[model samples]
Target: MVEPRPDQKKGLKERCPELLEIARLVSWCMNRDYLIRSCLDHINRRLGMRARCVLKEKEQLKLHCWLGEYECRMEQMPICKESIVWKVVEEGIPVNLTETHQCEGYSHTLGEKVKIKAIVPLWYADQVTQEEKRVGALIVDSGKMGMPVSDEDFEYLKVVGELIGAAIGKAELTEQFIDSYKRKEIMVRETAHAFRNRIAAIGGFSRRIAELARDKDLANEAKMIYHEVQLLESHLEQFEKYL
Candidate 1:
C-alpha cells in the first residue's frame, strides 16, 4: 500500500485546530458570503486540499468561496440553477461524488475527475422547521487521479459538515428573525398612523359641535351632535387599545 504523503499527514494534524476556528467563524457568519468564505478557508487549511463552499441562493447554488493550489473548475462554468447540488440544498441532504456523478446534471456541472471526496451538510440549528433547506455543502477535493478517499477521511468530513451545517442554520434563523421583527415594526407604525387619523377626525367633529352650541337657535341640535361626538371619541379610545 502507498504511504500517505507527508503533506497529507501534516494536513491531518492541522484539522483539529482549524475545526475550532471554523466553528467560531461559521457560528458568527450572518450570510451566504460570510459562511462560504469561512468554510472554504477552513477546509483548505485543515485538509490541505482544494476546497470550496457553494451557497444556495434563490433558484441556484453558486461557488462563492474557493482555496487551493489550482483554480476551481466549478468556478469556470456559469452556474446552472437547475443542478443537483441545488436540488440537494433544496432537499437538505449531503450528496457525495458517488451520488454527484450518478446524476446527469451534476456530472455536467462538476467535472468527472474532480472526484468530490465528500459532500457534508451544514445544518443550521436556528432553523425552526426541517422544511427549511440546507444552506450549502462543504466540498473537499484531492487532485490525485482515481485516488479513493479513505473511510476515516469521509468520517472526518461528516463531522466538519455538521459543524458547517449548524453555522448555516444559525445564520439563516438570525436573518429570518430579524426580518420578522422588522415586518412587525412596520405593521405597528402603520396601525398607529391609521389610529391617529381616526382620532383627529373625531376631534375635528367634536370642535365643530362645540362651536354650534354657542348659537341659541341651534342649541338642541348642537347638544345631540355633542353626544354623538362623545360616542365616536369613546370608539376611538377602544381602537387605541387594540393598536
Candidate 2:
C-alpha cells in the first residue's frame, strides 16, 4: 500500500486526543436527543463556528439541534435536493464552499447576508448489516466575514460525525432492549394472573370438598390442599407487584 502524506499522518495524530474526549462525551449521553444536542454543542465550541444538526424527516430536512449566532426562523423546513446540505447527506460526502455567494441553494437557505463555508454528512452504521446509513447533516457557517474552513477542520468534522453516529446507534439499541424487557415482563404478568385464577378456582373447590367430606381423613387432605393453594396465591401476589 502507498504511504500516507505527512499532513494526513499529522492530522490523524492531532485528532487522537479530541477523539478520546468525544468518545467520553458520547458515552455520557444516555438518550438520542441528548446525544444529538451534546454533539452539536461540542462541535460548535471546538471549532468556534456555528453548527446545526439537520435530520431528514420525510422528504424535508428538519433542524434538530443547533449552536451558534444564526437565529433560525423555522425549526422545520423543506430542503431541495439541489441544496448543498441535502446533497451532502444524500451523497454521504462532505462539501466545502469557498464562496457562499456563488451557491444559489446556500444563499436561498440562509439568505444573502449569512455566509456558509462547509457541510458534512453524519452517518450511522447499521447494527446488523454494518452498512453506513445517513442520519443527518452537520452544517457549518462562519456568519458575515465568511471564514475559511481548513482541510483539518473537515477531517475533524467527519470524526465528530462518526462519534455522534455511534452514540445514536447505541442509544437506539438501548431503547430496543428496554422495550423488549417491558414486553417480556407484561407477558409474564399476564401469564401469572391467568395461573392465579386457575389456582384460586382449584382452592375454592377444595374448600367446598373439605366442608362436605364425611371421612375425617378425606376432609383433612382437602383442607391441606386448600391451605397450600392459599400460600401459592400469596406468593404470586407479591411477585406481580415486582413486575
Candidate 3:
C-alpha cells in the first residue's frame, strides 16, 4: 500500500478546484444516481482513468456507475472476504494494486486485467443500528503496463472517495425524505377534502335554517354560521394549494 503525501503544492493547488466543486455537489446534489455519475466523471476526467462505482445491496456488491473504456454488461456479485472490494469496503481502507486480476473476484468486478487500480470505500451510518457502515466502493483504473499510476493520482482519488461517499449517502437520504413527505402530503389532501365536504354540508343546513326561521335574531345567527363556513372553505382551498 502507498501512502498519500502532499509534497507537491502545485498538484494540490490544481486539484483544489475539483475538490471544491465536488464538495458543492455533495452539499446540493439530491439524486443518488446523478451524484455518483457526476463524481465518477470528475475523477475519471481529471485523472484520465477508467473508473467505476459499486454499492452494497442485500449483502451483494452491485455495479452502480461505470466510466470504463468499454461497454459493461456484468452486474452484481457476492462479497467474498478476500476480494479487494471487501478489503476497502468492509474494512474502511483504501488499496492501490498493480495486478487486479490476482485479486479474488476481479473478473466479477471488471472483465479484463487492469494494469493498476485504486479502490476506496464509501461509508455511512445505518439508520436502524446507528453504527457506521460502508455503502459502496469507488474503483479507478489508471496507468498502462509501462507507466504505472502516479502517486498524486492516488492522493486525489483518496480525497475524492472521502467526499463522494457522503454525497451519495446524502442523496439517498434526501430521496427517502422526499418520498415520505409526498406520502404525508397525500394524506393531508385527503383529510382536507373530507373537511371541506363537512363544511359545505353545514353551510347548506345553515342557509336552509335562515330561510325558514321566523325570528329575525334566529335568521341572523344562521346567516352568520353560513358566512363563517364559506370563509373556512376558502381558507382550506388556499392551504391545499401548498400541499
lDDT of 2 by residue, 1-243 (tens): 112234433365687887798799788778777777777776666667777788877667877887777644645555555667777788898877777565764424654344447778877887878887787887776666577566777777778878887887787778888999999998998899899999999999999999999999999999999999999999998998887
Give the local distance difference test score of model 3. Answer: 0.74
The list of candidate 2 runs beyond 4 A from truth reads 1-12, 58-60, 71-78, 99-108, 112-116, 128-131, 215-221
lDDT per model, in order? 0.62, 0.75, 0.74
Which scores higher on TM-score, 1 or 2?
A: 2
Clashes of 2: 0
After TM-score superposition, what is the CA distance of residue 228 in candidate 1 from its true location, in Å?
15
Candidate 1 lDDT for residue 157: 73
TM-score, cand. 3 vs. native: 0.73
TM-score-sorted candidate list, best first: 2, 3, 1
Candidate 3 lowest-lDDT run of ten: 1-10
Candidate 3 Cα outliers beyond 4 Å, as residue runs: 1-14, 24-31, 70-82, 99-108, 113-116, 124-133, 143-151, 214-217
Instruction: Give the number of the best model, judged by lDDT.
Output: 2
Candidate 3 structure quality by residue, lDDT tens digits, 1-243: 122234422265588988899988888777778888898877666666677888888778777777745544545555444566766787898887765455645443444545367788888775657777688888887434323456677788888888887776676677788999999998998999999999999999999999999999999999999999999988998998877
